[model samples]
Target: MRLYFFSGLTTSCNTLKFDSLKLHNETSNHVTSNNITDESYWYYKNSVDGLWRRWDISVNSETNVAAWKMKWLNQEPKNILGVIVYLTSVRELPQLNISLLSLRQNLFKPRPIVIFHEGDFNNVNVQLALATTLGTNIPISFEHIRFPTKISIKSKIGDLRLGYNHMCKFFAIMLPYHPLISSTFTFYLRLDYHSYLLGPPLTYDLFDHMQINQFQYAFLMVSTDELKFVRELWVLFQEFLNDSCIKPSSAVKKTQITAATGLYSQAVVFNNFEVSNGSLWRNEPRIHAWLRKVDNAQGIYMYRWGDAPIRTLAVTQFLDDNQVVKFRDIGYFHRREYTCSSRMHSCSIPSYHRLASHIVYREGCHP
Candidate 1:
């Protein structure tokens, strides 16, 4: 029965009035106008494996993708694990050198999880009976070569490390690509992030009564958010501390390095800004239409950005400067003429936009 409570004046002492149940030690948090830490803390501590699973099925021969819900789990918390890889483009398997699963994650390291699909998409009216059957087990693992940042799904021959997000520092296990095909083949995916506490090795197997007591109380407090609703809960927490008799709790918790700045906030801001201002979808209004979550899936939690789904998912840019790749006629995708070379990460995304009057990926795929 771990319990945690807080208010405007809650201190370190009474914070443990019920510390006997805590699994860790005292936690101190504060708010800042542009604060990213609080949200980061929540992401690393709770958002991993946080959303409820929604099962969706499809048939036929088309491509569909989804980014579903992600939230916190009051119960067991753990980090997220996923993988994405392109199976085949032809109706049958090609004689490739190695299975996508066997491919080395990067030139130097090995990826943990692996996923692979069999077959290709030649029969449009055809059910991907065999291919999809193999897809269910594909664990999401991005090639490690995409270091510092970058995650790409599908070994389909391009460097795709960029992911999308509409961040307010709030994250959940989001299944971004929900593949469905009824005459349509779709992609199904899940997103999540969790603490490193429940990780491998020597963890919280200690004997601390006071910390346990505090955790017993905090655990009962629903979410750190709910505690804020009650008036003077912080004050009560402080009063408990003034007693001096109460000892501090010792509860172990784990969070991502980003937790200090806000879980993926900076990254989200960077990626979204790239997408919002770049070309990822076909049409703005059409993209908005696609943004609506169906079947009460995971990602949709009440609209933000504009409260107008139309605007938030609106298409901003449609230029691909890399190699010319197109998602149907929606638009084209290409690498930027001027991107961060191994030697220089000089040009920012916006700056990349500046190099060429318009992206010329339709112009080519490599330098």
Candidate 2:
């Protein structure tokens, strides 16, 4: 799957490593040959002797002077992950140091590591001229959120090409009786909004741009340039409350998700095929199995889908709760909320995405 992170180093991502089990983008430097098993390429294995590794990259016409290069040499835990920067000028290298060393963090979580950019760096004089000329836009990206803390995310709200920054409400397709007392339609709308932002910019000739205008207004109270537009948009949307956002007494709208832990020892097939954690043997082999693979969790969404038969996450991160501070950064998003009632015990909030979709939740059947 393919996804675009709204935040993170501006560089396109390629791999998600975990002890010999690696995922690398097809176009990345380390994955070009398409011979993942060849194991004899230049970019094959730079990581430790055992820990999983994957490297990725592709060609682009992005930089010339003061550019940045990533040399993640798979060194010791915290030995060598530094930016080899090409700045426009050394006159203010000290200022750029903040951008240079932001990646050198000591946090237990993976904070957003990055390098700021400007003009030519190799030449001290040119570097200074470029920095001053493009001072305002130098940082490239900023964070309304932090990372590697209680939160598991990092991102850069780059130019519009990254994705649209807007608000979307999550609607309870099942619960229409009490709209306000259910999971806010925020998440569902968000995926649509992502389609907008990540798709491409719209070009209109004004007179016939009424549709665009209404669309923009629906997302933001007032619109200006991209940056200011999102600020206004955020406030306008937050007011509408949902069962998850504001916990209050109200006519219940939707089912809740209950968390149960245990073990599974058997399997049953709709037809004659087996579906286990390891085999994602396309839904047709059996039936729909998309949502089934997503472990239940709040604030979840899918990021990428592509030719590799694997997944590539572009922007798979969401705010944790009210603060909009801590968030869960993942390739796809899902959440499970426990609901208690007058039943024998408790049940989890139920959600269905396309009908007849294969339903697979972690549990053991009663003997």
lDDT of each: 0.20, 0.18
Per-residue lDDT of 1-367 in model 2, one digit per residue for the tens? 0111211221212441122222222232323332244332112221123121222112111112122122221121131111111211345444343322221221122211211122223344543443343333232111010011122322223232111111100111111101111111111111110010100112321112212222110110000122322222222112212211432111111101112422111111110000011111111111111111221211221221110111101011111112111111111111221112222132332232123332222221111
Using alpha carbons, what is the TM-score of model 2?
0.18
**Candidate 1, after superposition: displacement of residue 159 in Å?**
32
Write one digit per residue (lDDT tens) for candidate 1, span 291-341: 332112212222112111221112111111121111111111112222222
Identify the leading candidate in terms of lDDT. 1
Residue ranges of candidate 1 with Cα displaced over 4 Å: 1-107, 112-171, 175-268, 271-342, 345-367
Give each model's clash number.
88, 60
C-alpha lDDT of residue 312 in model 1: 17
TM-score of decoy 1: 0.20
TM-score of each: 0.20, 0.18
